[model samples]
Target: MNDDRLEGAGGEDTEEHLLRSLPGCIVAAVGMVGIAGFVLFLVARIVRSLTT
Candidate 1:
């Protein structure tokens, strides 16, 4: 029952888990950057409008 081929039976599983989870991390990072950029752009536009 301890064969390496069995499910959830190796350090490789942890590495695989992390690899699978990487996409979520990448998506979150992109979303955060996009939101930050959008907010900053909006703020800059508002300031420009106010000054004019």
Candidate 2:
């Protein structure tokens, strides 16, 4: 009843907060992946140079 309605309202605020921040979260994830890939690529190149 009244408690249920208050709970639902709180849920909506959390949902909206997540939706607002989702894009920033996605961009940070993508940036981290890209940085990891670049670091791996550099390590491979260095190892190849050492072996050859």
State which candidate has the highest lDDT.
2
Best by TM-score: 2
Structural RMSD, model 2:
6.5
User: Against the correct fold, how does model 2 do in TM-score?
Assistant: 0.78
Candidate 1: regions farther than 4 A off:
1-12
TM-score against native, each model: 0.72, 0.78
> For model 1, what is the alpha-carbon lDDT of residue 39?
100
Residue-wise C-alpha lDDT for candidate 2, range 1-52, written one tens digit per residue: 3554455577766676667668989999999999999999999999999999
lDDT of 2 at 39: 100
Which pairs in model 1 have colliding backbones? none
- Model 2 residue pairs with clashes: none
RMSD of each: 6.1, 6.5
